[model samples]
Target: MRPFHYDKPATATDAVTNFRPGAQYFAGGTTMVDLMKLDVMKPARLIDISGLEKGRYDFIKWSGKSLRIGALTPMTKLADDDKVRARVPMLSDALWLAASPQIRNMARIGGNVLQRTRCPYFRDTSYEQCNKRKPGSGCAALDGGVTRHHAVLGTSDKCIATYPGDFAQALVALDAVVEILGEDGPRSLRFADLHVLPEARPDRETTLAPSDLIIAFSIEDADFPRSKYLKIRDRESYAYALASTASALRMDGNTIADVRLGLGGVATTPWRAREAEAALRGGPATEAQFARAADIAFAGASTTDENAFKVELGKRTMVRSLLETARMEG
Candidate 1:
């Protein structure tokens, strides 16, 4: 951590009011602080927003038709909520299967979704060819660097780093909307549109403005009782995913009435397999259909020698998630 000014605003409006260029909002500091320590990110000032809007933003509201979660709500709080687990189990499972218990206890949902990629090339400053770290420089990972953990989908020539978060995948599958309060006031955007693919501008990861403060996430029709988040990794616990899927399925006997799929660990963003979901919808809930849907999901995948296996692994993960979700009690 280099020398920087710190400010803790009393309210959300106050926090946005004090925002300036090169200033970063600090909440859980789980991801930001880690980067700051590594000198990967050096904001001129840090505005602590964790204390702001505690009563308003640090909450979880579940209406029968919808659910709204405060941005400041801790990962553990929402994951352990009986209502969330019973109704939208995918959301709970994603959070539960994320970082260790200590991290979940303090990590807020807003920051979790906005967390930076864990690419070694981007994090370690010694590597001088990271487009995400320094735009126009180039990507070291694409040039024969260790890419076992890099992305296989939504990858551009400029960057192949994967979005390393579980909760965002769940939100994408559920079509959650993110509410934002910026210097220009408030607005809402579809969660699916929040993260842009790393095309030419690899440094620009999210669509959020520098001063925009995420207020909360809202989801309409939050009644996905038959849902699951399945993650495959090198280890069983406390590890980043290699290929993961968040699946929510509604079955009409043996036929799929509705389906939603969000893929993680194999993509540059929280990936919504809309094509896969379309193929599964109104189809028989069987391994053959599931495999076909999986094929459609990875049809546009671009892979490297080190990470090419992600295509097959990602497909298998999605198929397994759908199978597990379909087996859930109605």
Candidate 2:
């Protein structure tokens, strides 16, 4: 890692004022530090914002109508929160299933959502053709590389790097809103719109401005007691998802009153399956309906030779998640 200046700002305003082109905000440092060691991210300065005011952006609160989670809140804290576990079990499950105890203890919710892709070519500096690593450059994974872990959905000719986070999927499914504080003051955006598809400029992953600081996430309360996060991976634990789904449902007898779905591991970003949710809403809550919804979810999936199986796997994962959620007592 290159030498860099470090600054710890106690307030959000100060952090934004201190932001520069080559400066990066330090929260959990799980992603930033790892990328810096790999030489994938070289920041000239580190602005430590983790010590910001606690009540402002470092606490989790449920206001009866919605859940507000501070951006700097540790993953473990969120996972273990009683209210979160009871009300939004899917969010808790997503956090618990991610990384390990040590990582979850150190990783922050904001940084987790903003984590970079785990594509080998993108992380390895030796590979000079990673479009996400270097804009306008070719994508080595697309040409010839180990692509079983790459994306099959929301992919483009420019890049096929898979999003490698769990919490974002839960947030997307719950229709969370991301609050931001920037030079222009504060604003909020849909969580689903935070990440950008790897189109022409794959290097530009998120819609966040350089000077913007993620403040918190707001998720509206709903009758989604029957919710789950199901992740299928190569291993039983401490592994990234091969195919994952976050399923939340509200059933009126045997009919689905409402549903929300988010897919991970097989997509370029935290993919909200709006189409699938639409198909399942007000429909019979059954295996057949779940399978049909899954089919619609992966309908537009594009894949390469090695990762093509992800389409089927992702669909199956969604179906299983929905079925499991449907069986849960709400």
Candidate 3:
């Protein structure tokens, strides 16, 4: 890792002001430290904001119709919270199914959403061609590189790196709002807008400004007792998803009253399947309807030779998640 200055700011304002062009916020350090060791990220400075005002960004509260989660809250804390597990099962399940116990204990919600892709070419400096690692150089994953673990949805010719996070999928499906602190003070934006597609500029992964720091996420409480996060991978544990789905359902008798769907592991970014949710709303809660919704979700998906199976796998995953959610006892 490259040598860099470190600072621990006690206040959010100070943390935002300390942000420089080549400075990175050091929170959980699970993702940042790994990339730094790989030489994939070489920030000039590291600003530690984990010690910021505790009351402001380290607590979780549920009031009225919304659940507010501080960014600095550890993944394990959120996953184990009774309120989170009972009210937002998908959110809790996503966190629990993520990295091992030690990682969840150290990883924070803020950094988890901003975690970078696990594309081998991007992580291995030996590979000279990686658009996400070095823009304008080219993407090695598109040319003979292993793509079975890459993305099929929202992929561009410039990059096919798969998003490798679980919690972000729950946030997107629940229509959570992200709170950010920057040089200009604080601002809020839809969680769905946090990540950008790997368009022509694959290096630019998110819409966040260099000076912006994610502060918290707000998700509205709803009747989503029948919710689940289903992930499929090569192994049973400690492996990234090949295809995953977050499904929440509200049923009125046998008909679907409302639904929320978010997809991961097969997309370039946290994908909210709004079209699929629209198709399932007010429809019969059955396997056929779920399959149709799944088909609608991946209608625009583009695939490569090795990862073409992901399209079918992703569809099946979605259908299975929906069916499983439907069977849940409220």
Model 1's lDDT to the true fold? 0.94
Off by over 4 Å in 3: none
Q: Which candidate is the best by lDDT?
A: 1
Worst 10 residues of 1 by lDDT: 48-57
What is candidate 1's lDDT per residue for 125-174, written digit by digit as tens? 99999999899999999887999999999999999999999999999999
Per-model root-mean-square deviation over C-alphas:
0.7, 1.0, 1.0
Model 1 TM-score relative to the real fold: 0.99
Compute the lDDT of residue 5 as modeled in candidate 1. Answer: 92
lDDT of 2 by residue, 219-316 (tens): 88633679989999999899999999999988899999989899999999999999999999999998999999999999998888899999999999
How close to the true structure is residue 15 of candidate 2, measured as C-alpha lDDT? 92
> Lowest summed-lDDT stretch of 10 residues in model 2?
53-62
Clashes of each: 0, 0, 0
Model with the higher TM-score, candidate 1 or 3 = 1
Q: Give every collision pair in model 2.
A: none
Q: How close is every model to the real structure, measured as TM-score?
A: 0.99, 0.98, 0.98
State how far residue 200 of model 1 sits from its true place (Å).
1.3
lDDT of each: 0.94, 0.91, 0.91
